[model samples]
Target: MPAKSEAQQMAAGAALAAKRGEKKVSELEGASKQMYESMDEKELEKMASTSQKDKPTHNRKS
Candidate 1:
């Protein structure tokens, strides 16, 4: 049996990474589409805030 060439191994690894990245992008797109379709402006705006921002004013300092 022959060993695999370096170029072949690199190509295979790159192809696998590309496939995984594409899957992640597709999932995010689906989520964004669902959110846009289902959420009202107020709800979406509320969701945009960080937890820190949601705390009372006195709880945070500059």
Candidate 2:
């Protein structure tokens, strides 16, 4: 998914790093860590809803 903000971009990068074993989730620091930790399920759902609205559709014909 395309990240909509700096925090989202950083979080995505961190998740990718963790998945590749380059870093542990516990190793996250600074804004990335704070943002990740601060999100609850409800907040996550709200973010997802807003992000979905911001996403572009790919079904258009040339």
Candidate 3:
């Protein structure tokens, strides 16, 4: 929807990646690392998916 929300979604995805061992917590920075450490796999997945569903749409003004 909004830029802020999109960034949050990206952070959640990064958290999920860390959980899956695709990335390290140390590799992530700032809020992303904090979010990853604060959430479990299920929670991260849920948040990521929810954000994906809320992605902004580009509608042409025809």
Candidate 4:
């Protein structure tokens, strides 16, 4: 699924980087860390690729 907000997309991007070894998983924290652990590359790619235009910085619901 696509990211619901800019923050979610950012977190997914971080996680995707770690998944691809572009960034260390140790560099992740909070939602990014969780995503790295729980999501696969494709799922993260979908979320990270979601356009941030007109989206909120953060989703209100957890």
lDDT of each: 0.37, 0.53, 0.72, 0.96
TM-scores of the candidates in the order shown: 0.35, 0.42, 0.70, 0.95
Arranged by TM-score with the best first, the candidates are 4, 3, 2, 1
Ranking under lDDT, best-scoring first?
4, 3, 2, 1
**Error at 52, model 3, angstroms:** 4.3
Best by lDDT: 4
Task: Give the poorly placed runs of model 1, Cα more than 4 Å off.
Answer: 1-28, 52-62
lDDT of 2 by residue, 1-62 (tens): 34465456556456455545677869887745654566653444444334434444332336
| TM-score of structure candidate 2 | 0.42
Candidate 4 ranges beyond 4 A from true positions: none
* Cα lDDT for residue 28, candidate 4: 98
Q: Which runs of model 3 end up more than 4 angstroms from their true locations? A: 1-4, 51-62
Model 2 stretches astray by more than 4 angstroms: 29-62
Per-residue alpha-carbon lDDT of candidate 3 for residues 1-62, written as tens digits (9 for 90 to 100): 22236667778789889989999778999767987878888888876766446554422345
Q: Residue 32 lDDT in model 4?
A: 98
How displaced is residue 18 in candidate 2, in Å? 0.5
The all-Cα superposition gives candidate 3 an RMSD in Å to the true structure of 6.7
TM-score of 1: 0.35
Encode model 4's per-residue lDDT on 1-62: one tens digit a residue.
99999999999999999999999989999999999999999999999999999999988975
